[model samples]
Target: MGSRRHTWVRRLGAAWLAAAAVVGTAASSAAASAPTPTKSTAGPTPAELKRVDAHAEKQRERLRLPGMALAVVKDDEVVHRRTWGKDGDGKPITRQTPFLVGSLSKPITSTAVMRLAEAGSLRLDAPVRRYLPWFRPSGPSADRITLRNLLNQTSGLSERDGIAHADRFDNAPGGVERTARGLAGARTGAPPGERHEYSNANYMLLGAVVEKVTGQPFGDYLRKSVLRPFGMDGTLVDERDAERRELAPGHRYFFGHPKRFDPPYDASGVPYGYVGADIDDLSRFAVAHLGHGDAAARAVVSPAGLRELHKGTVPAGTSHRYGLGWRDDSFEGERVVWHGGATPGYHGTVVLAPERGLAVVVQDNAYSPQRDELLNATALGAMRILLGGRPAAASTDPMLDAMLTTVTVTAAVLALALLWSLFRIFRPSRGRPRGRRRIVVGAAVSVTGLLVLAVTAVYVLPRQVTVDLSEILLFVPDTGWLLVAIGVLATALAVTRGGLAVRACLAAPPLARTDPDAVRDRRQEARAGV
Candidate 1:
């Protein structure tokens, strides 16, 4: 009986082994037929790129800008480039179209400073007095000024020092120097380190320092030290060169109308604004911000110097910190460095997400009060898309729209009021509403309008914008002059009507009629203000 049981067990074990062989053969065949998986690649996803392009196009259309260019950089290369609309003259915009990337000039200017420092020609912490013996601000802390402070905009020089026009760039005696020297008695914010104050004059001053240190014109020094090394040959340092490029027309946003303006040569503004470049050339700049690798590695500045250029030195007015030439912010805890610019007819931005190895540059040929916002929106939106996030909605401040509406309505209302005042003065007074208070009110409004106009349109506004009334007209056109005209006209109307109202008030109570009830009736009418 035991032998018979052993034989049955051996037979069952053989059957199990045969079934295992069949399963293994089938598994091997399936594995051989399946395809192998490849590695995930770097750069923005296709969906993300499409979304960025759509957003750029949407903004271009919505704003009706003359032209626009966009480029994205990832892992040391531009993975995408795009252009939209046409030149102001209806020329098709190409990637080579130059945009006057205003004040975005600061980063390149600051980069040159860093290179100078790396070459032992300058020091970041040294007093401005060390390099620019001529920089004399009215502030008590003037000697406390440093090169770093100027680059980070904490030197506290006010916009009042921004040279009002580009002629300062000319060869006139003390032309640009005169503009820089104007900062000697210029006002400053808090002492250098106390707070952040954004001023173009700070950089304009640095441009002088660069000129002194390099013994070259600011543009020539920058071209040799920074642009040439970075292979940014397409970058034009001269504002005149910008005019010669396939440059697009610039437009001014006036109320709701677009008024085209001749682009000016802002020579004194070169250090802080007025540099122009194509999207392709600017992609090299975006790549340079990536640090330590790739095509931009050929630039003269050491990696350490490049890193220093990005350090947050002070609080930027926005949600970022102002570094050398870069504005520093964070995206979902990752580092974001960027700058934006708007000149007479252009708005542009360049952004870098170092951790993600991504950057974006956008430029358009249109000027508006909200131009900075338009560029910033595209930059931040591009960052979001590159970081695998849905682009945030464009941030147009409703208050700006409301203010523009108010300007239009107030202008219309002022016109009507002026007309009514004239009617009251010229029309029959025998049978009509008559009151000294009405005329007084009209006079008071006129006086108030005059005071408001003097304070705002003449004094405070020009100081705030660092441009005179004429410059304002050149940039914004029509709107400013119209406002000034209304103010002048309103003041005249008020004076004339107010005099008549006073004369009516003082006139001998309509002669009292010489009747017994005449005195009483006149007194009653005077008391009742009839």
Candidate 2:
């Protein structure tokens, strides 16, 4: 059983690695072949809008999405706005239906921080401790972290640390402050400002900083300073407000099927990932960011401040850069400022091409870790259509359905094998092992291999995916529990085999063990059995 489970796990790993390689190659080739962004003064034509709508509907049906909302804005006007499918309540989704816009909240929070800076309330380059004297993490370098470092995600906090504190579902008072203070126990992978490591902890501390400086809750200040000015009237900064607006319950994929998941409000995560908005609300925010004669956009932040917010100050990857809250990158060689966000059950993306005076906002009620890239493609594909280019070929959904199916079948086989092993260990033996020494050695090797497999599955695999086991369990319960089952069954099998080997050694005949001919005969018998 241990050997069989090990083989299954190895096969799963190999499949994942191969899939990743294929995706990487496809992405690189797409980028290389993408045409340069063309500056167009005209908006998307009616036929173009039709194509966009058709594409959205195709994707929704193909992915079996529960609900979705999309809006395309040109200059200061929304040229196209549409919705398809139903919400958790079975009502049709609308422009005003609130959906949790995960890390898209970062831009709004960053906007609030910039407003404070514009009024001389705080300095971007100043150490965080300058404002919040209690601000201190474990490392000495923590003291040198500036507001800018957090904004650009160069505060030295790793993704692992962020996942550790994320999705806390803590609705209690002072959760944000508590999360910030709790970082005193968190370890940093690098010194502040030395590397760009995205972490929700950075924005959590920023939320605390906002609270300390403004003497108001992070939500309150963000609404007054950012949302209101941008005409995002349908937006809500916290769970209570979202509930009042009847925020649509989001969905999580279970074996390729969408299941409703009404996750608890994470108050501590609002600044980084939990803000809620509808398509209309996001469209207005996009228009504001575009800043092409939109008075609301001009009034909220100065040209200099807006530029700073979209500037790529730190490198994130080969072609991507992290700005204050936005990601500066290219879509088809066209410069685009964008950000995509996800929680347990929702996915959303906002893309802005200021040069072309175009912006796109796409939001869906369903989300899954495996479908993250595919969901993001919805927004990118829309942008491509608007840019008068054919959208890139759609990639596969990362084979999540296949992976989960394999896990299920493998678990069943392992369970049966474990049961058979247990029965063999307890049932009356047909005969004692003639090669007791060989049996013991083989069992020892099996136990050692099983233990190594268990450790790798429970620990190393999660790190390779840049998350912890807890996160996997929280987001992908089926996969997580199946992994636990495999490890447990392997251990059980190891114990049973070891016990049988020990019993054989104890029952062996001493004369047979001392005789070379008998030993050879026993070895032949054991080989035949094997």
Candidate 3:
């Protein structure tokens, strides 16, 4: 079944590529008639890159981030790029590593759909039910949900009736069918196209449609049509299962102790599967969009689709003016086209400045508090210098970065010291060993660590960092830190409890020493020595 499904996706993907080529040809002719942008190789300078690095680091620190990978593009070329911090386990991260780009898949999917449209195989404004007669939104809303709405996120429908659940049921056997059934029977919060609401269900359903229309699975289609053409060879999709190729682990903080990065798939369990790409591959994607497939000159999106994708399909400010697959808006008076992606343990944001011929992509294994603000600020500052704008003030949040450095180093030192002390104290004493003394010391350290972690996670850290709903703490917020603290405390307590249990057994009295049975008993006693 999987093989058959993949075959269908491949055929559709080929058809889409053929269509993209035809569209590219026509668009190129048209672009020749339009006004050209001022081009430059003098992208953001090294000093600007330095500022960006510092700012991104601060954002990482503020959010308790494990690691981040970034790519900056200017005039169809990679002007700057970097990887910062550690992997899911605080192991250092590298630019070649992959991090999940969650809903960012939507734009890629939309682009493929547009290629189909260019082929005259589909239309954006068509009723989705037309393609799949079995597909329909629940009740009266059925007639209102269009392909355009699904792309723009203004569809009056949501997955699971707006209720959240833990498992990735949408990807399970018959999950897609069940989800389609749920939507067909579901109700909407707003009238069709009345408002824009981000819904994963929208894209998952779209994935199914792409499959149905092209007779291919989403991932296979993406690889053949998008990734291959754009040179995003390092990009990965649907990491529901682990694969070792260039993947980064995801993580979340355990309550009072240090933030625990999770195993790759376990780290951040995203509902829908995602596309994971390294910084360089992502930059290539950015260049494709900026270049729009003009091999001689650089461009990614077909100019017509790119323009349409940027046009506000939903009302501006009604819900961030969602377009075909991306969002369009003015950030600090500069027209910015971008999207933000979040999956279980990972957070990412991509910003593109069409006028400046510049783009930025930021990906983190764990959520970063600063997010696009610091990255965006740094990008803008760099652009200012390049464009000869007035010098901006120092935005390198030194205090936050310094504090984070101190905390991390101190924690490592303390943990190592504690371990060393524990090994010494727990070792059988050369003479007059006291089991009770060892227990007392272990319990004291464990309890003290737990208390300190609780204070930091619950009060100190949360107070110290600025928490925002739309930022890194979107899902858990107060509860996330609380969960982390509690998990840590529980682990510490478990260790102490095990030690105490061992102590109890060792402290028991011997029944007999002379008998062979007594000797056997004595060996057990020695094995359980305090």
For each candidate, what is the lDDT? 0.66, 0.76, 0.55
lDDT of 1: 0.66
Best by TM-score: 2
Q: Which candidate, 1 or 3, has the higher TM-score?
A: 1
| Candidate 1 Cα misplacement greater than 4 A, ranges | 1-41, 163-175, 292-297, 432-457, 460-479, 495-530
Alpha-carbon deviation at 22 in model 1, angstroms: 95
TM-score per candidate, chains pooled: 0.81, 0.84, 0.62
Determine which window of 10 residues in candidate 1 has minimal summed lDDT.
Answer: 28-37
Task: Give the alpha carbon lDDT tens digit for every residue of 1-530 in model 3.
Answer: 00001111222224323432442243211111211244744568787677677766765675556677777778667767777777764567787777777656667777777767776777788888887677655655667677888788777764333223212324444344454444554556676678776665566566667667777666666777777788876677544433756465575433311244443332111223366777777777766665443452233345666677666557534334678767776544456677666555666666776666778787777533213234334434434443445324544233333333333443454455446545644773455434454555666666555455434433444333332212224333334433343435434544654565466436633324334687887789889993
Cα deviation of 201, candidate 1, in Å: 0.9
Count of backbone collisions in candidate 3:
20
Model 1 residue 327 CA deviation in Å: 1.0
lDDT string for model 2 (368-459, tens) is: 66666678778888898888787777654445556666556656766787788778777847864466667667778777766655555566
Best by lDDT: 2
Considering TM-score, which of the candidate structures 2 and 3 is the better prediction for this target?
2
Model 2, residue 311: C-alpha shift (Å):
1.9
Better of 1 and 2 by lDDT: 2
- Model 2, 521: alpha-carbon shift in Å? 18
lDDT of 1 by residue, 348-368 (tens): 888877656688898877866
